[model samples]
Target: MEHSIFVMCILAVLSIALANPIFQDFSQLKAVENANKVLQLVDQEVLSNHKLGQQSSLPQKIDWREKGYVTNVKDQGQCASCWAFASAATMEGQLFNKTNNLITLSEQNLLDCAKSYNDKGCAGGWMSHAFKYIRDNGIEADGTYPYTATKQECSFNEANSVGTLQNYVKLTKTTEEEILKAVANHGPVGVYVYMSSLFMGYKSGIFEDDSCTETPNHAVTVVGYVNTPQDQYWIIKNSFSKSWGEDGYMRMKMNKNVCGITYRLYYPIV
Candidate 1:
Protein backbone atom coordinates (compact mmCIF):
# COMPACT_ATOMS: atom_id res chain seq x y z
CA MET A 1 0.00 0.00 0.00
CA GLU A 2 2.86 2.40 0.90
CA HIS A 3 4.65 1.64 -2.43
CA SER A 4 1.42 2.34 -4.37
CA ILE A 5 1.01 5.75 -2.60
CA PHE A 6 4.63 6.73 -3.47
CA VAL A 7 4.09 5.98 -7.18
CA MET A 8 0.92 8.13 -7.26
CA CYS A 9 2.79 11.10 -5.67
CA ILE A 10 5.57 10.89 -8.28
CA LEU A 11 3.05 10.82 -11.16
CA ALA A 12 1.28 13.94 -9.80
CA VAL A 13 4.57 15.87 -9.52
CA LEU A 14 5.52 14.99 -13.13
CA SER A 15 2.16 16.21 -14.42
CA ILE A 16 2.59 19.59 -12.70
CA ALA A 17 6.08 20.09 -14.11
CA LEU A 18 4.91 19.38 -17.68
CA ALA A 19 2.06 21.85 -17.33
CA ASN A 20 4.35 24.82 -16.50
CA PRO A 21 4.84 27.51 -19.16
CA ILE A 22 8.14 27.48 -21.00
CA PHE A 23 9.59 30.76 -22.28
CA GLN A 24 11.90 30.49 -25.27
CA ASP A 25 14.05 33.54 -24.54
CA PHE A 26 14.49 36.71 -22.48
CA SER A 27 12.73 38.81 -25.14
CA GLN A 28 9.50 36.85 -24.81
CA LEU A 29 9.60 37.00 -21.03
CA LYS A 30 10.31 40.70 -21.12
CA ALA A 31 7.42 41.21 -23.48
CA VAL A 32 5.13 39.60 -20.96
CA GLU A 33 6.43 41.82 -18.15
CA ASN A 34 6.20 45.00 -20.24
CA ALA A 35 2.81 44.14 -21.70
CA ASN A 36 0.93 46.26 -19.19
CA LYS A 37 3.02 49.36 -19.87
CA VAL A 38 2.69 48.77 -23.61
CA LEU A 39 -1.10 48.48 -23.66
CA GLN A 40 -1.38 51.51 -21.38
CA LEU A 41 0.15 53.63 -24.14
CA VAL A 42 -0.46 51.75 -27.41
CA ASP A 43 -4.22 51.32 -26.91
CA GLN A 44 -6.49 52.55 -29.73
CA GLU A 45 -7.60 55.85 -28.20
CA VAL A 46 -4.05 56.98 -27.36
CA LEU A 47 -2.52 55.73 -30.60
CA SER A 48 -5.13 57.47 -32.76
CA ASN A 49 -4.77 60.73 -30.85
CA HIS A 50 -1.00 61.16 -31.38
CA LYS A 51 -1.36 61.82 -35.16
CA LEU A 52 2.17 60.46 -35.47
CA GLY A 53 2.20 61.17 -39.22
CA GLN A 54 2.62 64.94 -39.57
CA GLN A 55 5.98 65.12 -37.75
CA SER A 56 9.06 66.10 -39.84
CA SER A 57 12.30 64.18 -40.18
CA LEU A 58 15.83 65.28 -39.45
CA PRO A 59 16.71 67.30 -42.56
CA GLN A 60 19.22 65.64 -44.87
CA LYS A 61 21.28 68.81 -45.05
CA ILE A 62 21.62 69.64 -41.39
CA ASP A 63 22.20 73.39 -41.40
CA TRP A 64 23.56 73.46 -37.86
CA ARG A 65 23.57 77.23 -37.78
CA GLU A 66 19.88 77.33 -38.71
CA LYS A 67 18.61 74.09 -37.14
CA GLY A 68 20.41 74.10 -33.74
CA TYR A 69 23.49 72.68 -32.06
CA VAL A 70 24.33 68.97 -31.56
CA THR A 71 26.81 68.39 -28.73
CA ASN A 72 28.39 65.39 -26.92
CA VAL A 73 28.22 64.18 -23.34
CA LYS A 74 31.48 64.05 -21.42
CA ASP A 75 32.23 60.37 -20.85
CA GLN A 76 30.72 59.34 -17.49
CA GLY A 77 32.25 55.89 -17.56
CA GLN A 78 30.61 53.21 -15.33
CA CYS A 79 29.16 55.90 -13.10
CA ALA A 80 25.41 56.56 -12.70
CA SER A 81 25.64 60.23 -13.60
CA CYS A 82 23.80 59.49 -16.87
CA TRP A 83 20.72 61.17 -15.42
CA ALA A 84 22.71 64.30 -14.57
CA PHE A 85 24.39 64.41 -17.97
CA ALA A 86 21.06 63.92 -19.76
CA SER A 87 19.28 66.55 -17.68
CA ALA A 88 22.11 69.07 -18.07
CA ALA A 89 22.29 68.53 -21.84
CA THR A 90 18.56 69.21 -22.29
CA MET A 91 18.77 72.34 -20.14
CA GLU A 92 21.98 73.36 -21.88
CA GLY A 93 20.36 73.08 -25.30
CA GLN A 94 17.37 75.10 -24.16
CA LEU A 95 19.60 77.83 -22.78
CA PHE A 96 21.75 77.79 -25.91
CA ASN A 97 18.76 78.02 -28.23
CA LYS A 98 17.38 80.96 -26.27
CA THR A 99 20.59 82.99 -25.80
CA ASN A 100 22.39 81.77 -28.96
CA ASN A 101 25.40 81.10 -26.72
CA LEU A 102 26.23 77.62 -25.46
CA ILE A 103 26.04 77.04 -21.71
CA THR A 104 27.54 73.94 -20.12
CA LEU A 105 25.59 73.43 -16.94
CA SER A 106 27.16 71.38 -14.16
CA GLU A 107 26.34 67.68 -14.48
CA GLN A 108 28.52 67.12 -11.46
CA ASN A 109 26.34 69.45 -9.42
CA LEU A 110 23.22 67.38 -10.10
CA LEU A 111 25.01 64.12 -9.42
CA ASP A 112 26.36 65.29 -6.09
CA CYS A 113 23.60 67.60 -4.85
CA ALA A 114 20.35 65.97 -6.01
CA LYS A 115 19.83 63.45 -3.19
CA SER A 116 16.25 63.92 -2.06
CA TYR A 117 14.60 61.57 -4.58
CA ASN A 118 16.73 58.44 -4.10
CA ASP A 119 18.72 59.21 -7.28
CA LYS A 120 21.91 57.15 -7.20
CA GLY A 121 24.02 59.77 -9.01
CA CYS A 122 25.62 57.82 -11.86
CA ALA A 123 23.35 54.85 -11.20
CA GLY A 124 20.06 56.15 -12.81
CA GLY A 125 17.22 58.65 -12.44
CA TRP A 126 13.91 59.91 -13.87
CA MET A 127 13.69 63.11 -15.99
CA SER A 128 10.75 64.31 -13.97
CA HIS A 129 12.76 64.15 -10.76
CA ALA A 130 15.67 65.98 -12.38
CA PHE A 131 13.31 68.72 -13.54
CA LYS A 132 11.92 68.98 -10.04
CA TYR A 133 15.44 69.55 -8.75
CA ILE A 134 16.01 72.33 -11.30
CA ARG A 135 12.70 73.88 -10.39
CA ASP A 136 13.43 73.90 -6.68
CA ASN A 137 17.08 74.89 -6.98
CA GLY A 138 18.07 76.97 -10.01
CA ILE A 139 20.98 75.59 -12.04
CA GLU A 140 24.44 77.19 -12.39
CA ALA A 141 26.46 78.00 -15.52
CA ASP A 142 29.24 75.68 -16.70
CA GLY A 143 31.79 78.45 -16.24
CA THR A 144 30.43 79.19 -12.81
CA TYR A 145 31.29 75.54 -12.27
CA PRO A 146 32.62 72.44 -14.05
CA TYR A 147 31.49 68.80 -14.33
CA THR A 148 32.63 66.00 -12.05
CA ALA A 149 30.65 62.83 -12.92
CA THR A 150 31.66 61.11 -9.71
CA LYS A 151 30.16 61.80 -6.31
CA GLN A 152 32.35 64.73 -5.27
CA GLU A 153 32.01 67.47 -2.72
CA CYS A 154 29.60 70.26 -3.77
CA SER A 155 32.07 73.18 -3.67
CA PHE A 156 30.26 75.67 -5.95
CA ASN A 157 28.81 78.83 -4.46
CA GLU A 158 25.00 78.76 -4.09
CA ALA A 159 24.53 82.39 -5.11
CA ASN A 160 25.86 81.64 -8.61
CA SER A 161 22.61 79.94 -9.69
CA VAL A 162 21.69 81.40 -13.12
CA GLY A 163 18.08 80.64 -14.16
CA THR A 164 15.04 80.02 -12.01
CA LEU A 165 12.69 77.02 -12.20
CA GLN A 166 9.89 79.19 -13.54
CA ASN A 167 11.80 79.51 -16.82
CA TYR A 168 10.86 75.90 -17.77
CA VAL A 169 7.50 75.26 -19.44
CA LYS A 170 5.81 71.91 -18.90
CA LEU A 171 3.48 70.37 -21.48
CA THR A 172 0.68 68.07 -20.36
CA LYS A 173 -0.60 66.62 -23.67
CA THR A 174 0.54 67.85 -27.11
CA THR A 175 1.38 66.63 -30.62
CA GLU A 176 4.89 65.79 -31.87
CA GLU A 177 4.89 68.73 -34.33
CA GLU A 178 3.78 71.06 -31.55
CA ILE A 179 6.79 69.93 -29.52
CA LEU A 180 9.17 70.07 -32.50
CA LYS A 181 7.93 73.51 -33.51
CA ALA A 182 8.44 74.49 -29.90
CA VAL A 183 12.07 73.37 -30.12
CA ALA A 184 12.59 74.95 -33.55
CA ASN A 185 10.85 78.18 -32.67
CA HIS A 186 11.15 78.36 -28.86
CA GLY A 187 14.14 76.27 -27.74
CA PRO A 188 15.24 72.73 -26.71
CA VAL A 189 12.55 70.37 -25.47
CA GLY A 190 13.10 67.86 -22.62
CA VAL A 191 11.54 64.68 -24.02
CA TYR A 192 11.43 61.30 -22.29
CA VAL A 193 11.64 58.51 -24.90
CA TYR A 194 11.31 54.73 -24.68
CA MET A 195 14.90 54.12 -25.79
CA SER A 196 15.27 50.72 -27.49
CA SER A 197 18.35 48.50 -27.64
CA LEU A 198 18.89 49.25 -31.35
CA PHE A 199 19.30 52.92 -30.47
CA MET A 200 22.19 52.24 -28.14
CA GLY A 201 25.57 53.40 -29.45
CA TYR A 202 23.78 53.94 -32.76
CA LYS A 203 26.18 55.57 -35.24
CA SER A 204 24.18 56.89 -38.20
CA GLY A 205 21.09 55.81 -40.14
CA ILE A 206 17.34 56.34 -40.50
CA PHE A 207 15.71 53.81 -38.14
CA GLU A 208 12.15 52.62 -39.09
CA ASP A 209 11.49 49.22 -37.43
CA ASP A 210 9.96 48.76 -33.96
CA SER A 211 10.85 45.08 -33.59
CA CYS A 212 12.49 46.01 -30.32
CA THR A 213 15.09 43.40 -31.25
CA GLU A 214 16.87 44.90 -28.29
CA THR A 215 15.82 46.07 -24.85
CA PRO A 216 15.35 49.76 -24.03
CA ASN A 217 17.64 50.85 -21.19
CA HIS A 218 18.45 54.54 -20.48
CA ALA A 219 16.81 57.94 -21.11
CA VAL A 220 18.12 60.80 -23.35
CA THR A 221 17.34 64.22 -24.84
CA VAL A 222 15.80 65.19 -28.20
CA VAL A 223 17.99 68.26 -28.73
CA GLY A 224 16.85 68.73 -32.33
CA TYR A 225 14.72 67.27 -35.16
CA VAL A 226 15.29 66.71 -38.90
CA ASN A 227 13.14 66.04 -41.97
CA THR A 228 14.79 64.02 -44.75
CA PRO A 229 12.91 63.04 -47.91
CA GLN A 230 13.76 59.43 -47.11
CA ASP A 231 12.50 59.52 -43.50
CA GLN A 232 11.87 61.70 -40.47
CA TYR A 233 14.24 61.41 -37.53
CA TRP A 234 15.04 62.77 -34.11
CA ILE A 235 18.56 64.06 -33.41
CA ILE A 236 19.33 62.65 -29.97
CA LYS A 237 22.35 63.26 -27.76
CA ASN A 238 23.22 60.62 -25.19
CA SER A 239 25.16 60.62 -21.90
CA PHE A 240 27.02 57.39 -22.64
CA SER A 241 30.80 57.70 -23.03
CA LYS A 242 31.85 59.33 -26.31
CA SER A 243 33.19 55.95 -27.42
CA TRP A 244 29.59 54.81 -27.92
CA GLY A 245 28.56 56.14 -31.35
CA GLU A 246 29.38 59.33 -33.24
CA ASP A 247 30.55 60.76 -29.94
CA GLY A 248 27.20 60.00 -28.27
CA TYR A 249 24.82 61.19 -31.01
CA MET A 250 22.40 59.19 -33.17
CA ARG A 251 19.24 59.40 -35.32
CA MET A 252 15.97 57.52 -34.54
CA LYS A 253 13.04 56.83 -36.88
CA MET A 254 10.02 59.07 -36.43
CA ASN A 255 7.66 56.24 -37.37
CA LYS A 256 5.59 54.23 -34.85
CA ASN A 257 6.59 56.49 -32.00
CA VAL A 258 10.24 55.64 -32.45
CA CYS A 259 11.72 56.05 -29.00
CA GLY A 260 8.06 56.34 -27.97
CA ILE A 261 8.08 60.12 -28.61
CA THR A 262 4.32 60.33 -29.26
CA TYR A 263 3.49 59.33 -25.69
CA ARG A 264 6.15 61.78 -24.49
CA LEU A 265 5.10 63.91 -21.56
CA TYR A 266 7.79 66.56 -22.04
CA TYR A 267 8.86 69.77 -20.30
CA PRO A 268 10.95 72.61 -21.74
CA ILE A 269 12.63 75.90 -20.90
CA VAL A 270 11.31 78.67 -23.10
Candidate 2:
Protein backbone atom coordinates (compact mmCIF):
# COMPACT_ATOMS: atom_id res chain seq x y z
CA MET A 1 0.00 0.00 0.00
CA GLU A 2 2.78 2.42 0.92
CA HIS A 3 4.82 1.29 -2.08
CA SER A 4 1.85 1.84 -4.39
CA ILE A 5 1.52 5.41 -3.18
CA PHE A 6 5.27 5.97 -3.49
CA VAL A 7 5.32 4.89 -7.14
CA MET A 8 2.24 6.96 -7.91
CA CYS A 9 4.03 10.07 -6.75
CA ILE A 10 7.31 9.21 -8.54
CA LEU A 11 5.51 8.59 -11.81
CA ALA A 12 3.87 11.96 -11.32
CA VAL A 13 7.31 13.48 -11.07
CA LEU A 14 8.65 11.56 -14.10
CA SER A 15 5.67 12.57 -16.23
CA ILE A 16 6.85 16.14 -15.87
CA ALA A 17 10.40 14.96 -16.48
CA LEU A 18 9.37 13.66 -19.92
CA ALA A 19 9.72 17.18 -21.24
CA ASN A 20 13.51 17.25 -20.86
CA PRO A 21 15.35 18.02 -24.10
CA ILE A 22 16.88 14.58 -23.91
CA PHE A 23 13.39 13.10 -24.20
CA GLN A 24 12.25 15.46 -26.93
CA ASP A 25 10.15 14.42 -29.92
CA PHE A 26 11.57 11.80 -32.32
CA SER A 27 12.62 14.15 -35.17
CA GLN A 28 14.99 16.09 -32.94
CA LEU A 29 16.85 13.00 -31.77
CA LYS A 30 20.38 12.53 -33.12
CA ALA A 31 19.61 8.82 -33.21
CA VAL A 32 16.20 9.33 -34.83
CA GLU A 33 16.78 6.43 -37.22
CA ASN A 34 17.37 4.14 -34.24
CA ALA A 35 14.62 5.78 -32.22
CA ASN A 36 12.17 4.60 -34.87
CA LYS A 37 12.92 1.06 -33.81
CA VAL A 38 10.73 0.85 -30.70
CA LEU A 39 9.52 -2.60 -29.68
CA GLN A 40 5.83 -2.80 -28.63
CA LEU A 41 6.29 -4.85 -25.50
CA VAL A 42 3.79 -2.65 -23.64
CA ASP A 43 0.36 -1.90 -25.03
CA GLN A 44 -0.10 1.70 -26.11
CA GLU A 45 -3.84 1.66 -25.46
CA VAL A 46 -3.23 0.77 -21.85
CA LEU A 47 -0.88 3.70 -21.51
CA SER A 48 -2.52 6.35 -23.68
CA ASN A 49 -2.37 8.74 -20.78
CA HIS A 50 1.09 9.21 -19.32
CA LYS A 51 0.18 11.21 -16.26
CA LEU A 52 -3.33 10.22 -15.17
CA GLY A 53 -5.84 7.41 -15.66
CA GLN A 54 -6.35 3.76 -14.75
CA GLN A 55 -2.90 2.88 -16.09
CA SER A 56 -1.43 5.59 -13.90
CA SER A 57 -3.15 4.06 -10.92
CA LEU A 58 -0.79 1.09 -10.95
CA PRO A 59 2.52 2.59 -9.94
CA GLN A 60 5.38 0.12 -9.89
CA LYS A 61 7.69 0.31 -6.90
CA ILE A 62 9.92 -2.69 -7.39
CA ASP A 63 12.92 -3.85 -5.37
CA TRP A 64 13.86 -7.40 -6.40
CA ARG A 65 16.13 -7.73 -3.39
CA GLU A 66 13.24 -7.02 -1.04
CA LYS A 67 11.23 -9.83 -2.61
CA GLY A 68 13.50 -12.81 -1.91
CA TYR A 69 15.53 -12.29 -5.08
CA VAL A 70 19.20 -11.80 -4.29
CA THR A 71 21.51 -9.95 -6.71
CA ASN A 72 24.87 -9.26 -5.11
CA VAL A 73 26.42 -5.83 -5.40
CA LYS A 74 29.34 -6.32 -7.83
CA ASP A 75 32.38 -4.11 -8.26
CA GLN A 76 33.80 -3.43 -11.70
CA GLY A 77 37.01 -2.17 -10.03
CA GLN A 78 39.28 0.15 -12.05
CA CYS A 79 37.67 -0.98 -15.30
CA ALA A 80 35.53 0.96 -17.75
CA SER A 81 33.43 -2.17 -18.14
CA CYS A 82 30.32 -0.77 -16.44
CA TRP A 83 28.34 -1.85 -19.51
CA ALA A 84 29.21 -5.49 -18.89
CA PHE A 85 28.08 -5.27 -15.29
CA ALA A 86 24.86 -3.55 -16.33
CA SER A 87 24.15 -6.18 -18.95
CA ALA A 88 24.97 -8.98 -16.54
CA ALA A 89 22.58 -7.54 -13.96
CA THR A 90 19.73 -7.16 -16.46
CA MET A 91 20.25 -10.72 -17.71
CA GLU A 92 20.22 -12.01 -14.14
CA GLY A 93 16.89 -10.29 -13.50
CA GLN A 94 15.34 -11.65 -16.71
CA LEU A 95 16.58 -15.14 -15.86
CA PHE A 96 14.85 -14.93 -12.52
CA ASN A 97 11.67 -13.68 -14.17
CA LYS A 98 11.53 -16.66 -16.54
CA THR A 99 12.42 -19.53 -14.21
CA ASN A 100 12.35 -18.04 -10.70
CA ASN A 101 16.06 -18.85 -10.39
CA LEU A 102 18.29 -15.84 -9.74
CA ILE A 103 21.80 -16.91 -10.62
CA THR A 104 24.57 -14.34 -11.03
CA LEU A 105 26.14 -14.37 -14.52
CA SER A 106 29.64 -13.43 -15.59
CA GLU A 107 30.69 -9.93 -16.56
CA GLN A 108 34.15 -11.33 -17.38
CA ASN A 109 32.64 -13.56 -20.08
CA LEU A 110 31.37 -10.49 -21.90
CA LEU A 111 34.52 -8.49 -21.20
CA ASP A 112 36.56 -11.11 -23.09
CA CYS A 113 34.29 -12.93 -25.58
CA ALA A 114 32.15 -10.02 -26.80
CA LYS A 115 35.08 -8.32 -28.51
CA SER A 116 34.02 -9.89 -31.81
CA TYR A 117 30.61 -8.34 -31.29
CA ASN A 118 32.20 -4.84 -31.06
CA ASP A 119 32.65 -4.68 -27.29
CA LYS A 120 36.00 -3.15 -26.22
CA GLY A 121 36.22 -5.13 -22.98
CA CYS A 122 37.39 -2.85 -20.15
CA ALA A 123 37.92 -0.06 -22.65
CA GLY A 124 34.09 0.42 -22.83
CA GLY A 125 31.02 -1.00 -24.59
CA TRP A 126 27.28 -0.54 -25.19
CA MET A 127 24.57 -2.41 -23.32
CA SER A 128 22.65 -3.07 -26.57
CA HIS A 129 25.69 -4.80 -28.07
CA ALA A 130 26.25 -6.71 -24.86
CA PHE A 131 22.66 -7.96 -25.03
CA LYS A 132 23.24 -9.00 -28.63
CA TYR A 133 26.25 -11.03 -27.56
CA ILE A 134 24.23 -12.76 -24.88
CA ARG A 135 21.47 -13.53 -27.35
CA ASP A 136 23.86 -14.99 -29.92
CA ASN A 137 26.17 -16.83 -27.54
CA GLY A 138 24.84 -17.55 -24.07
CA ILE A 139 26.75 -16.11 -21.11
CA GLU A 140 28.73 -18.09 -18.52
CA ALA A 141 27.91 -18.31 -14.82
CA ASP A 142 29.96 -16.02 -12.55
CA GLY A 143 31.01 -19.07 -10.58
CA THR A 144 32.48 -20.56 -13.78
CA TYR A 145 34.12 -17.45 -15.26
CA PRO A 146 34.36 -14.94 -12.36
CA TYR A 147 35.11 -11.20 -12.70
CA THR A 148 38.73 -10.11 -13.13
CA ALA A 149 37.85 -6.42 -13.47
CA THR A 150 40.10 -6.40 -16.55
CA LYS A 151 39.99 -7.73 -20.08
CA GLN A 152 41.37 -11.22 -20.62
CA GLU A 153 41.44 -14.02 -23.19
CA CYS A 154 38.07 -15.62 -24.03
CA SER A 155 37.96 -18.87 -22.09
CA PHE A 156 34.13 -19.13 -22.18
CA ASN A 157 32.94 -22.74 -22.29
CA GLU A 158 29.41 -23.69 -23.34
CA ALA A 159 29.35 -26.28 -20.59
CA ASN A 160 29.36 -23.49 -18.02
CA SER A 161 26.51 -21.53 -19.61
CA VAL A 162 23.84 -20.49 -17.08
CA GLY A 163 20.63 -18.82 -18.22
CA THR A 164 19.53 -18.36 -21.82
CA LEU A 165 18.75 -14.99 -23.36
CA GLN A 166 16.15 -14.99 -26.12
CA ASN A 167 16.66 -11.40 -27.27
CA TYR A 168 16.60 -7.79 -26.06
CA VAL A 169 13.99 -5.06 -26.56
CA LYS A 170 14.42 -1.32 -26.81
CA LEU A 171 11.71 1.00 -25.55
CA THR A 172 9.31 2.22 -28.23
CA LYS A 173 9.56 5.65 -26.72
CA THR A 174 12.24 7.22 -24.51
CA THR A 175 10.51 9.01 -21.68
CA GLU A 176 10.91 8.93 -17.91
CA GLU A 177 7.25 7.87 -17.81
CA GLU A 178 7.94 5.03 -20.21
CA ILE A 179 10.96 4.02 -18.16
CA LEU A 180 8.75 3.85 -15.07
CA LYS A 181 6.20 1.74 -16.92
CA ALA A 182 8.90 -0.68 -18.08
CA VAL A 183 10.39 -1.09 -14.64
CA ALA A 184 6.96 -1.55 -13.13
CA ASN A 185 5.77 -4.13 -15.65
CA HIS A 186 9.09 -5.66 -16.62
CA GLY A 187 12.05 -6.37 -14.36
CA PRO A 188 15.21 -4.26 -14.03
CA VAL A 189 16.59 -2.60 -17.19
CA GLY A 190 19.92 -1.31 -18.53
CA VAL A 191 20.17 2.44 -19.15
CA TYR A 192 22.70 4.82 -20.70
CA VAL A 193 23.49 8.02 -18.81
CA TYR A 194 26.20 10.63 -18.78
CA MET A 195 28.03 10.45 -15.47
CA SER A 196 29.33 13.80 -14.32
CA SER A 197 32.18 14.39 -11.89
CA LEU A 198 29.57 15.36 -9.31
CA PHE A 199 28.35 11.76 -9.26
CA MET A 200 31.86 10.38 -8.67
CA GLY A 201 31.56 11.09 -4.95
CA TYR A 202 27.82 10.66 -4.49
CA LYS A 203 27.08 9.59 -0.92
CA SER A 204 23.49 10.00 0.36
CA GLY A 205 21.13 12.35 -1.43
CA ILE A 206 18.72 12.66 -4.36
CA PHE A 207 21.21 13.34 -7.19
CA GLU A 208 20.21 16.09 -9.60
CA ASP A 209 23.13 17.49 -11.56
CA ASP A 210 22.37 20.61 -13.57
CA SER A 211 25.80 20.49 -15.19
CA CYS A 212 25.34 17.01 -16.61
CA THR A 213 25.90 16.72 -20.35
CA GLU A 214 23.22 15.61 -22.82
CA THR A 215 25.25 12.69 -24.12
CA PRO A 216 25.38 9.35 -22.36
CA ASN A 217 28.83 7.99 -21.43
CA HIS A 218 28.06 5.25 -18.87
CA ALA A 219 25.79 2.27 -18.38
CA VAL A 220 23.89 1.12 -15.28
CA THR A 221 20.79 -0.82 -14.16
CA VAL A 222 17.66 0.87 -12.73
CA VAL A 223 16.34 -1.41 -10.02
CA GLY A 224 13.40 0.71 -8.82
CA TYR A 225 11.84 4.09 -8.13
CA VAL A 226 10.21 5.85 -5.18
CA ASN A 227 8.64 9.15 -4.20
CA THR A 228 7.27 10.88 -1.12
CA PRO A 229 6.17 14.27 -2.50
CA GLN A 230 9.49 15.94 -1.67
CA ASP A 231 11.69 12.99 -2.65
CA GLN A 232 11.23 11.48 -6.08
CA TYR A 233 14.06 9.49 -7.65
CA TRP A 234 15.27 6.38 -9.46
CA ILE A 235 17.27 3.77 -7.58
CA ILE A 236 20.27 2.84 -9.74
CA LYS A 237 22.27 -0.27 -8.99
CA ASN A 238 25.81 0.58 -10.09
CA SER A 239 28.87 -1.67 -10.25
CA PHE A 240 30.86 0.57 -7.95
CA SER A 241 30.76 -1.83 -4.95
CA LYS A 242 28.85 -1.54 -1.67
CA SER A 243 31.10 1.24 -0.45
CA TRP A 244 29.65 3.64 -3.01
CA GLY A 245 26.43 5.63 -2.67
CA GLU A 246 23.67 4.01 -0.62
CA ASP A 247 25.19 0.57 -0.35
CA GLY A 248 26.19 0.40 -4.05
CA TYR A 249 22.95 2.08 -5.21
CA MET A 250 22.40 5.70 -6.17
CA ARG A 251 19.14 7.63 -5.90
CA MET A 252 18.82 9.99 -8.87
CA LYS A 253 15.99 12.52 -8.93
CA MET A 254 13.17 11.69 -11.34
CA ASN A 255 12.10 15.08 -12.73
CA LYS A 256 15.63 15.65 -13.95
CA ASN A 257 17.76 13.42 -16.14
CA VAL A 258 21.02 14.39 -14.48
CA CYS A 259 22.73 11.32 -15.94
CA GLY A 260 20.65 11.01 -19.15
CA ILE A 261 18.83 8.13 -17.49
CA THR A 262 16.10 8.09 -20.14
CA TYR A 263 18.37 8.10 -23.19
CA ARG A 264 18.86 4.38 -23.83
CA LEU A 265 16.42 1.97 -22.21
CA TYR A 266 16.42 -1.79 -22.78
CA TYR A 267 15.57 -5.07 -21.04
CA PRO A 268 16.39 -8.67 -21.85
CA ILE A 269 13.76 -11.12 -23.16
CA VAL A 270 14.75 -14.39 -21.55
Which candidate's lDDT is highest?
Answer: 2
Model 2 lDDT tens row, 33-110: 112122111113221222311254546356766753449899887677878888998888888877888898999999
lDDT of 1 by residue, 149-268 (tens): 467666646798765454444444456766566555544455555434345325567655565432232456666667656667776666666655566666766545665555444443
C-alpha displacement of 248 in model 1, angstroms?
2.3
Against the true structure, candidate 2 has what lDDT?
Answer: 0.71
What is the Cα-based TM-score of model 2? 0.77
Stretches of candidate 2 off by over 4 Å are 1-56
Consecutive 10-residue window with the lowest summed lDDT within model 1 = 39-48
Please give the CA lDDT of all the candidate structures.
Answer: 0.54, 0.71
Candidate 1 Cα misplacement greater than 4 A, ranges: 1-72, 170-175, 213-217
Q: After superposition, how far is residue 103 of candidate 1 from its true place, in Å?
A: 1.6
Score candidate 1 by TM-score against the native. 0.64
